[model samples]
Target chain A: MPSPRYTRDIPARYRLDAARCSACGHVALPRRTICSGCRSQDMEPVRLTRRGTVVTSTVIHVPPDEFTTEAPYAMAIIETPEGARLMAQVVDCQAEEVVPGMELSLEFRRIRREGHGGILCYGHKGVPVRRHEA
Target chain B: MRDVAIVGAGMTRFGELWDASLRDLFVEAALAGLGSAGADRVDSIYVGNMAAGQFVGQEHLGPLMADHLGMHGVPAVRIESACASGGAALRMGFLDIASGQSDLVLVAGVEKMTDGADVTNVLATASDQETEVYHGITFPGLYAMIARLRMERGTTTEEDLHWIAVKNHRHGAMNPKAQFRREISVDDVARSTMVAEPLRMLHCSPVSDGAAAVLLAPLDQARRYTDRPVRIAGSGMATSTIALADRPDPADLDVVRLSAERAYAMAGMSPERVQLAEVHDCFTVAEVCCLEALHLANGSEASQAARTGYSALGGRVPVNTSGGLKSKGHPVGATGVAQVIELFDQLRGEAGERQVPDAHVGLAQNMGGSGASSVVHILERV
Candidate 1:
């Protein structure tokens, strides 16, 4: 998942845009052209729910060069209520604190910088839902 | 399809061979395999490589290696499936002989991983760039998530993972060609530096530079190359979505299961019948998952087999007797071909101390990128 020039999916990557299958109602993240669960080509655009729960999480100690400063950070696979899963870094929490079943809310954040003094790449990351509760 | 048999096997000592170029490694393994076969009737060549372009800034390895091996004018091609490139190439070579397209074929797997570059980034390119790897996750972090999920299920324990490293290192100690040819206890694994929490350095395969090669011939004429030949009874390969998140289940690898089923069906044998195996152990967690997917163990209980020493060498089913990709060193593309080399040595009774007694039928399962794709082959001594 190192930084690459994926300019096409900017909308989906930034806004958490997804494709909702017209036939089977299966939702795919990052806006799929066709439904993954169903063989249906008919799809509709939808904004994914920012709120989700951590399905799985890990503390990345030895990270990539782009994330050297963020070593020993928490990353997780957050599953939304609509049944779409996306990987996002867990901010506003300790690495060990982000465990399975923890409530989270997706927030737009700076993911990393690509190339030398390249463009500032921004995407969705998971923040503990407790901040919103307060 | 006609019967296909492997008449020769060879590979370079897997490690950080700083002096060896990608071409040097391939030629060493290819010539050793040809020497083992004792013939030069190879009509075609297939090279399995993952990322020659990224790792060593080289590409078009097919013609390059074929010409380097003195296999001039023969048809040459490259097969790639991330880490499973080596295994996938073997499957392609098997088909070449089975389809009667080539009388003899050379299949080789090679990778140059230690060029003083950031290999972690090069390997991560195999994962989903936009979705997963973009989240600042390395390869270890990906598998660590799998291990975390399995641990939450209470079916797999940290000790279960440690057992895999312990058993593989024990086997690796006897393998002179292995990268880590020294044994270590469970504590050694526990104390090793954590690359990703719950996945330590000892639990991960090392960055290596090496190559492996095998020669395939029709079963009817295999004896012309070597008195002993291993038959490629079955080969199966399957692919899933590239992103692990796209997969229906992170708890298990369905690609491995589906591919192994096709292989078992072709071979007409069950997992119990096989005397030994070399499942892809890219991570310690991967081996346990593969055991169940290969039907060597049942469900998540595969970790139980590891804990009980049932998967150890000379146990219920010896897995990774050549130390696997873990202790043996994973040069990525060369791994699949290297696995068959282990089976060749074991089945022919050439494996000295690590030989599984009376080993006959063996299975080698190679997977790519968090089990998105898998290639399974069943080989038997004939």
Candidate 2:
């Protein structure tokens, strides 16, 4: 990935910043000028919640070049209470343990290194929400 | 617009063709198509190639392929829509003839995937780089998520999925041009190494290097080229969200449904009228989804089509009779053109062993990037 492209997505990756369309209330992550739902340009910047529920997931055993070291990791589509969805890696648990309906909190973490001498890329990863023991 | 017909079709045997360069594959397929049509030259050419720049470090394919095929000075262009590039190019050729702009047009799709480039990374470029690919999601990973959702919804089962590979491999055994030309049982598919959960290595289409080409002409002039010409009845293309997660229902594949609806509407036919089809089965789950989306089967019937032999040869609506992307080979851009070749062969009674009896109408559905884009074409034996 190019450095400029990575830098442009920092706000969404780091803070879950999204844009909500005033016309149809559709929230677009990483923001967009035009609305996908209603094609309206009336949009407002909003911060998405850090927590979401897993909509679907897959454990990637054969990964791409950048994520080879993180093989056997779970990546999932997480839906937030705001009705927005984003894809993120589900970490801090076994890959097989991440399932649909599981609750997770997105946390800022180092995603991967572009190459041997490339800069470190950081993004949000899903951490399983644990319950308090009585 | 005037009606268009495919007067000729040809393709290179799909596999790891380390001996063939990108230009060699295109020229070979182009010559075969021209020879089959008995035409000394074409008025224009359209090349369907996904990533020649990334795979072979070459671009400007329009002129490059035209010059190599000895058709320089003719109008030539390349069309791309990820994996659906072939179908998109065919559509362009169809329009060119239908609009009276060209009399004879050649459409070819080629990909040299064995060229030492990182195939996975090159393919990943089709997806949303910042959103999806940045997270390390391979194409298998995307389809695996869809498979999981389908399994959870009872739309398909692991066993049902394996039946697809089994059926395609069985059909591929009869196709001399297929890459994997041997039969396999459901057990064989189940025992294969798992690439992504619910999708084994057998369930995925292999990365391949090959090319396919077709010659198109106005329906009125088609007889001058061939005695038996397959009429291109309808062509439709549609798109959806690039990122799979953006869809309301990832398994629905609305792009396929929309494109098929347009094609069926234009053809003045319904899904039932399609006697045979070559659907994009990049993954086993994809075939299941495409069946339902194309309206060839509904609900669980899509999953059960293979198990009950309904989708196999000699069934109600034989599908993937030329193997499929699963067993035949998916050289990205070449897949759509290859699908047309299969339909053309079957319609003309040229497909020796896996021919669909009395096949009059056929459909080809090609999709790209986890169903983000789709192209549907309906053909009739004219």
Model 2: lDDT of residue A14: 86
Clashing pairs in 1: A1-B133, A1-B134
* Best TM-score among the predictions, by candidate number: 2
* DockQ for each model: 0.85, 0.84
Give the CAPRI class of candidate 1. Answer: high
Against the true structure, what is every candidate's RMSD?
A: 1.6, 0.9
- Residue-level lDDT of model 2, residues B238-357, one tens digit each, is 999999989999878999999999999989998889999999999999999999999999988899899899999988888899999988999998999999999999999999999888
After superposition, which runs of candidate 1 have C-alpha atoms over 4 Å from their true positions?
Answer: A1-6, A131-134
Reference-based lDDT, residue B319, model 1: 91
Tell me the TM-score of candidate 1's A chain: 0.90
Q: After superposition, how far is residue B277 of candidate 1 from its true place, in Å?
A: 0.5
Q: What is the DockQ of candidate 1?
A: 0.85
DockQ of 2: 0.84
